[model samples]
Target: MKLFNWPNIRLVLMFSLVVFLFSFTSNRNSQRKVAKSTVIFVGNIDPFINQETVNKLLIENNQDPQSIGKDKLDLNKLEKSLNGHEMIEKSDVFVSIDGILKAVVKQKTPIARVFNNGHSFYIDYEGNTMPLSDNFTARVPLVSGEINKKNKEDLADLFRIIYDDAFLKKNIIGAQIMPNGSLLMFNRNFNYQIDFGRIMNLEHKFKNYKAFFQKAVLDSSLYKYKIIDLRFSQQVVCTK
Candidate 1:
């Protein structure tokens, strides 16, 4: 076993050179200024915030993303700021090797827009309320009248239920919570109103409606009723 063989010496020298180059590259990259910022909005839904807005947010603390050096960039802190935004559901910030400050942002998906007391806001899929965006409006269900904590929770349940069921999602466009605590749904294609009664036994009520809709479609009688009631356990009460 040779202590200082040519192969061993060569290997050590090579390792040293590699480390030196890595250190040099790292040092160079650390000082590299971010050229610009690119925002990527995840998901198929329309973005609530635009690229300009995102770039502005990246520098909201008066730190310019384009001029800020990589070493000076606080990615974690920046991400926290982004996540704290009311419209943002999740966010990730990182600088690319080429000096591009890239941000991946996902906005809260609104399931319904609530209107009450002359105020309007959005209710997301996570049951969180978000302010309406000026950039885009989601074509989700419109929930008007008698909005409260309990009512919002029930509406969230209905939203999830509708979203899960394609038929309900496509047909039911909006809902109304009456002052008497009864819930009503508006059909997209029909002029009649649906009386859901209460939030209890939601699965049963929807099932009954589905059965009635199928029968009505078969008979071409859906338009004959002014009100479709699903309050009872076993039947659809229709008013013509």
Candidate 2:
């Protein structure tokens, strides 16, 4: 009986019309063609890979996607390819409703540069090795002389400590491994060497050095010493 009600039928028809219009609009938008593609390197990307490099990578993979159908472009594959780059830590590829293909990438950061034998390369913060870039050289702490691959983690940790302390980072320029497996540190501002010995007791050694340096600075005797030994426990030994 109520199935013929005028108001109910009118409301149902209006709802159906709105639903049909929304579906039509969505389908039309989904089929729109891609107009352009853009690559964005998000973090610390300079001196490594640039926009042109990323664009070339896309072209190589045939994923340039300019003027192509948005629905046909494979964004997942684009991301996968970008992530495969050694310098790229992570990447995200996506397309907007206006058919603009975009990729955002994150770059890896290096903590130390190593010179072993005749080869030179960078060691990332995670202890991973990275190739040097001809465009720019990172001003991180240099590791020369003999380098032991077995102590990679220790080297990484030493760099991290230097990076965290602004005073030490600015003063300490390089390090070397002696024949006895001991370590020696050099400062840019001072002509003397720091006999760091082994990598252990870093916190205690740096503290002793800091205290001794403060005293030496007051007496204008910092440059007079040639070697400041921090190998002993809770003591600093200096030689001229």
Q: Superposing all C-alpha atoms, what RMSD in Å does each candidate have to the true structure?
A: 1.6, 2.6
Worst 10 residues of 2 by lDDT: 55-64
lDDT of 1 by residue, 1-240 (tens): 998999999999999999999999999999999888899999645878788877777894696878878999999988988898889999999999999989999988888888988999998888899999998988888988977777777778878888778999899999888888888889999889999998889888999999889889888798889999999998889999
The prediction achieving the highest lDDT against the true structure is 1
Worst ten in a row by lDDT for model 1: 43-52
lDDT, each prediction = 0.88, 0.81
lDDT of 2 by residue, 76-124 (tens): 8777888888777788888887878788888777778899999998888
Alpha-carbon shift of residue 158 in model 2 (angstroms): 1.1
Q: What is the TM-score of each candidate against the true structure?
A: 0.93, 0.86
Task: Let me know the TM-score candidate 2 reaches against the reference structure.
Answer: 0.86
